[model samples]
Target: MKSFRRHTESHRTDSIGWLRAAVLGANDGIVSTASLLVGVAAAGASPGTLLVTGVAGLVAGAMSMAAGEYVSVYSQADTEAADLSRERSELEADPVAETRELTAIYVGRGLEPALAQQVATQLMAHDALGAHARDELGISEAFTAKPVQAALASAASFAVGAALPLGIAWLAPAASLMVWVGLTSLLFLALLGAVAARVGGASMAVGAWRVTFWGALAMVITAGVGRLFGAVV
Candidate 1:
C-alpha cells in the first residue's frame, strides 16, 4: 500500500485541469464584476442602478463563461472521441499495420529496433489503445477534460467573483461608493493574483501585479467615461 502511494505521488503532474479551471473561474468572477461596478459607479449612476448593473453583469458573465467553456471543451472532447473511434477501427481492420506503426513510434522515441518491436507487441497485446492514447495523442485520465465540469466551474466562479463588488455596493456608503468599491475590488484582485500564482507555482509579485493592472485599467477607463457623462449632464 505504501509503495502504491509513493508511486502515485511520483507520477503527479504539475498541472491539473480542475485546478486551472477553479483558479481561472474565481479570478474572472472577482475581476470582471468589480470592474463593471467600478465603471458604472464612476459614471455617477444611482446606487439602485449600480446594484442592478452589478447583478446583470454577474449573471451575463457567468452564463457567457459557462457557454464558452462548454463549447470549447466540447469541441476538444469530440475530436478526442473521434480519434479514439478511428483508433478502434484501425485496431480491428489491420492490426498488423497498426502494430508496426506503433512499434515505429516507440523506436523514434529512443528504444532500439528490437526492443521497440517487442515492447510494442506486448503493449498491443495488453492495451494498444491506451498505449497509443498516451504516446500518440497525449491524452491521459489525468488530463482528459470534462466539458460539464469546466463549464460549471467557470460559471460558478464568475458569479462568486462578481458578488464581491455587488456586496460592496450594498454595504459601502453611497456618497463614496465608487471609491470604496474600487479600493476593495483592487485589493481582492491583488490577493487573488497572489493566491493563483501560488497555486500555479509562479512568481506572486508578477501574478498579482498583472491581474491588478488590467483590472485597475478597466475601472479607470469606465470611470473616465462616467465622469464625462456626469459632466455633460
Candidate 2:
C-alpha cells in the first residue's frame, strides 16, 4: 500500500508543475482579452477596429505571458541551483554535520530522535544526495522547474484563451457585437473557472460562479462607462 501510494503521489507531483501555470495562463488570456474586447466594443468602435484590437491583444498577450513565465521560472531554477550547490558543499566539507542535519529534519517531522537518526543513516547509505535533495534541499525531478517549457506552455494557453473572445467578435453582428462578446466571453470565463477548479481539486460550483460574477461585473462597468462617454460627447 505504501509503495502504491508513493507511485501515485510521484505522478501527481509532476502534473502540478505545468498544470498550475497552464491553467492560470489560460485564465488570464481569457479574462484579459474578453475584458479588452468588451471595453473596446463599449467604446462604440467599428467592427474592423475591434477585430484588429482583438488580434493584437491575442498576440501581444501571448508573448507577454510566455516571456513573464520564462523569466519567473528561470529565477526559481537559479535559486534551486544555488541551494543545491550549497548543499553539495556542505556534504563534501562536513558529512557528519550534514548527516546530523538530516536527522534533525526527520525529528522535526515528528520522528523519534533515535529512529530519525536510524532512518537518515539507511537513506544516506542508499543515496546520500537523494536523501539530502529530498529532505534538505527540497528538490525533486518530478517537481523540477523548466523555464522554457513553462514559458511556451503559458503562451500557448494564453493564446487559446484569447482566441475565444476573438472568435466571438468575428461571428457577432457589428451593431450588437458588444452584447454578444460580453455574454459569450462570460460563458467562457465560467466554464474556465469550473474546469480549473476540477483540475485543481476544488469546488466546481463556487469556482464557476466566482469567475462568472467578476467577469460580468467588469463587462457591465466597462459598458456603462462607454455609454456615459458616448452620451457626454
Candidate 3:
C-alpha cells in the first residue's frame, strides 16, 4: 500500500488586518510626500528647502499613520471586546437560549437541525464561550484586531515608502528636481501597488494602474497649484 500525503494551502485572508494598514501607509507616504516636494519645487523652493520639507513630511506622515491606525484598530478591538462580553453575559444568564441560538446559526448555514443541535451541544460542552464567540458572534482569531501590530506596521512602511522620493529629491539636480521626484514617485507607487496586489492574490496590472493614476493626478494638481501660488506671490 502507498502512503498518501495531505497538503494544506495558506490564504492571504489572515493578513487582511495588518496588510491593509501597511499598504495604505506606504502608498500615502509616497504619494503625499512626493506631491509636497513637487509642489514646493514648482513654487521655486531651493534644494535645501525641498529636503527639509521632505524630511518633515516623512516624519509627520509616519507618526500620523501610526496614530491613526492604532486608534481605528483599537476602536474595532473595543467593539469586539464589548460584543464578547455581552455574549459571555448572555451565555451565563441563559445557557439554553445561547445553545439554541448557536444551533440555529449552524442550521441556517445548511446543516440538518438534529446534527446542528448535536454539534452545537458538543461544542458548548467543550467550550461554550469559545463556541458562541466563534459561531454566534462571528469572532475568530484570524480576524482579531491587533492595534500595536497595525500601528507599527503602518509607521514603518510609511517611513520606508516616503524615503524613496526624499532620496531621489536629495540626489537629483535642482533644475529638474520636480521631474525626477514626480516620475520616481510614480514608479514607486506602481511598484507598491503591484507588490501589494501580488501578495493579496489580485491582478498586478490593475493595482499598479490604480495607484499610479491617482499619484500622477495628485502631484499634477499640487504642482499646478504651487505654480499658480508662486506666480501670485
Candidate 4:
C-alpha cells in the first residue's frame, strides 16, 4: 500500500500590496463616478451630459489610480534598496558585528542566548544578506514592491468598478436615473467590501457596512451640493 500525505496551505501575505491597491482603486472609482453622476443629475443636467461626465470620470480616475500606485510603490522600493545598500556596507565592514546583531535579535525574540547564537551563525553562514534582510531589516521577497503590477491592478480594477455605475446611468430613464444610480452604486460598494473582507480574512459585515455608509454619505453630500448650487444659479 502507498502512503498518502496531506499538505496544509495558508493565506498568502504577499497579496497584501496588490490587493490593497486594487481595493482602494475600485472603491474610489465606484464612489467618485457614482457621486459625480448623481450630483450632475440632481443639478438638472441632461442624460447625455450625465453620461459624458461619468465616462470622463472613469477614464480620469483609472489613470490617476495607476499613476499614484506606481509612484508610491516605487518610492517604497527605492527606500528598501537604500536600506539594503546600507546593510550590505555594514556587513562588509564588520561581519562579526552583523552576526552579533542577528544573534541579539533572536535572543530578544525569546530564544536562549546560546541557541540564538547558534541559529544566527547557521543562518548567516547559509545566506548572510538574506538572513539579515529578513530578520534585521524586516524585508522579504513576499512583501517586495512591484510597481508595474500594482499600477496595472489598480487601473484595471478601477475601470471595472467605474463601469457598473456608468452602465446604470446610461440605461436608466432620465427621470429615475439618480435613484437607480445611487441604489445600485451602494449595492456594488457593499458587495466589493464584503468580497474584499472575505479575501483578506476579515469581518464581512463590518467591511460592507463601513463602505456602504461612506458611499451613502458621499452621494448625499454631492447631491445636496448640486441641488443647492442649481437653485442658487
TM-scores, in order shown?
Answer: 0.88, 0.89, 0.94, 0.94
Each prediction's Cα lDDT score? Answer: 0.84, 0.85, 0.94, 0.93
The residue ranges of model 2 lying beyond 4 angstroms of the native Cα positions read 1-11, 224-233
Stretches of candidate 4 above 4 Å error? 1-10
Question: Per-residue lDDT of 122-215 in model 2, one digit per residue for the tens?
Answer: 9878888888988887888877789998998899999999999899999988888887888888889889889878877789999899988987
The predictions' CA RMSDs to the true structure, in order, are: 2.7, 2.8, 2.6, 2.9
Q: Tell me, by lDDT, which candidate is best.
A: 3
TM-score of 3: 0.94
Candidate 4 clash pair list: none
Sorting all predicted structures by lDDT, with the top scorer first, yields 3, 4, 2, 1
Residue 94 shift from truth in candidate 1, angstroms? 1.9
Minimal lDDT window, size 10, model 1: 5-14
Candidate 1 lDDT at 117 equals 93
Candidate 2 clashes between residue pairs 3 or more apart in a chain or in different chains = none
Clashing pairs in 1: 29-161, 30-161, 43-226
Best model per TM-score: 4
Who is ahead in lDDT, 2 or 3? 3
lDDT of 1: 0.84
